[model samples]
Target: MAGRLVLDGGTVVTMDGVRTEYASGHVVVENGRIAAVGPGPAPAVDGAQVVDVRGCVVTPGLVNTHHHLYQWVTRGLAVDATLFEWLTTLYPVWGCIDEETVGAAATAGLGWLARTGCTTTMDHHYVFPADGGDVLGAEVEAARVVGLRFMLTRGSMDLGRSAGGLPPDHVVEGIDQILGATSEAVDRFHDPSADSMLRVGVAPCSPFSVTTQLLTEAASLARDKGVRLHTHLAETLDEDTFCRERFGCGPVDYMASLGWLGDDVWFGHGVHLDDSAIALMAATGTGVAHCPSSNARLGAGIARLRDLKDAGVPVGLGVDGAASNEASSLLEEARHALLFARARGGPQALTVRDALEVATIGGARVLGWDEQIGSLEVGKQGDVAVWRVDTLAHVDIVDRVAALVLGDRPPLELLLVAGEPVVERDRLVRVDEQQVTDASREAGRRLLVKAGVAG
Candidate 1:
């Protein structure tokens, strides 16, 4: 458990600056760090666990910057509504959530992520029903069963409809309770080391769902604990209007006044940000989690990703929440990002390599984990995934990256985290697949019944 392993005879595609690909390459993993990466005739094959991946495409495991893993239970319930309508349609069902339901749903969602080649993911969970018993701990336990690198955000929504916010009163918490729970989560669950697997972030839900004071204090607490902060901002025109009316300032200016414009923060669904906001983000080294599929699903506008990247902003790809996107597949999200970007700003706005980089290195960088686990390079973590390129989904493709992004779903062979296999041949290894599916379906049934919509 504490030695090196050599994955030789594979097509290692490192999403480095050049998107380098090495045929018949060997990746040496020692003490969890990639010792070297090159062709065969590598050092130390004497006692290492040699995985001969001759025909597999070995690359860094996909990184997901945003998710609401508990939304797995509400996937089909809010199918064709906009952001506001969708939230209103699903809030009643979500109000019935308990810790047990969230645990089961999150486990299934994270397992799906692993099956699609994701090793690291950040969950943005904000719903806190009045009756839910310690939902945060339940999601955390689910991550352990799912067996992936996790960024668990202690997400809070303090402003309810009584205060002119979107969420119902029963789903929101007190400001003191929110901040107190966040600090407790940081002290208990947050890992601040270089080799940590479970890192915690302070997230104040969104501008509409939380007060300005909550954002300021959340940022302060995150900085004091040296953890990352995340939330939603400027997702749609309605959100922009809410910010202007409620805060008496635009989203960017409000965040700036709260000292939230910094490198350790990343906002989700940044589709409605203006040029000046982009400039401020670039100057402050702040990051954005671009959710292309969720935007299209909810009819939200396209994010100016190429513009953001051009302005030197850190842009990462996310699937958002499964309730909006229908599923949490990193490869599917990458494909959507490429096609969606081309649809907005012409064909060259985003390339296959750029899309791939967003799912891998860019996401890691956004979560501030690039140094430990992003690309298959020397001194990086051994988080590798093997997707089968021999199938019809990848047939007759000259460009390997195109074979992945442009075609149908490629058959996955294996996915690893820290050199340990979590997915093998397109199946999850850490969970009982059928059990999780049954649990999620049952939870959905209960929710539907509680909402008086079940047949």
Candidate 2:
């Protein structure tokens, strides 16, 4: 139970049903939920902590729909390779991760995301090494240390190189092992409450990395457990070719045949979808986690973001893994999403507000959490971000939202999840940043040495 808090005199952008914007407003929070939101000063309340955010932009804390937090230790590897080439080169190294390395990497990754104004993030972790002891538990503990809302999708890869999959045989698990572990993980971590700090989902790696039986059974398991489903789909030309050769159809059609499209499902990297695929997704209420930076980094094609938006598809922003997108900043994802959309579809492809929406409400929708945390409403949880727009990097911009989405990344004044401060004055509240960085560097060295890639 958090006490009362008041954020006064900031430009409030409520990404609600009406897209309301308050020029100067006050938001009062009580008992971990929004108590009031309106223009001008807040009503005086005794013993309330007041934060003067006169030059800041107050909005819902950013939601990251997709990520690979364990890849934090593998940043800057295979920099010039395509997706398949990159995966082949890194799988051997990733096969050496343990609970210690994963914990350190997740700490660094979650800390960085909090600094970049992300309040909630979902991690798709599929690489389960044979010797890796409780990797999922390690990351969940890391999230607790960083004090951010986390969703862990127990991702599985059952297809190996022997079976024509992308990953090597050493990194793949058996179907029974994968399903049992996924069920256990959900029972241990998932919280269905409106103000839950942690949740769990079921995710198979991708179309090319898993067998049809695994996909079908995983979907069935997720549905039976009442959890969401996620997987990579249509990410590259190579993926399309592989699916066409192996499954006798495109990636979208193959997944559709296995009953993997619905409001309870979201796919990462829907970059190679055609018009018919887009219509199918829209009709089925499936969502997309658009990772523009990773796609550009790996030379994957640009996703049809404008078309997805126009067709009423749920879409969200993602920074993806640090291995491909080394920056891994959710705020920068908004800028990249805007620039990439325009580069592909001209200047009118996306607006600044549109990018912000995808980062906030749009992402919440993808995670099936919009009713609680996506907007600055009276009854929603108090998950908010205060970006310092009065700084030198953003001071010149007239529109605060544009400054946030188009200009350079501004310092985060504050970030709150469930009314508790996770970041304050550009620093993490619960953990030491320098310590996290040092641990991550050590973890990276240890993993590379274990894999015989470094001495």
Deviating ranges (above 4 Å) for candidate 1? 1-3, 40-44
What are the per-residue Cα lDDT tens digits for candidate 1 across 1-455?
A: 34778877877888877777886687888877788888765676667887777766788999999999888988887687899999988877888888988998899899998988899999988888878888889988988887899999999988889989999888888999999888999899988777788999999999888987888888989999999999998889899998898778888888999999888999898898899999999999999999999999999889999998899889888988899988678899889998988999999999998898888999999999988888998877778888778776675787777888787878778777877778888898878899999999898888778778787
Which ten residues in a row are the worst by lDDT in model 2?
A: 1-10
lDDT: which candidate is best? 2
Clash list (residue pairs), candidate 1? none
| RMSD values, in order shown | 1.6, 0.9
* Candidate 2 lDDT by residue in tens digits, 151-255: 899999999999889899999999999999999999999999888989999999998889999999999999999999999999999999999999899999999
Error of 2 at 5 (Å): 0.5
Error of 1 at 185 (Å): 0.7
Model 2 TM-score on a 0 to 1 scale: 0.99
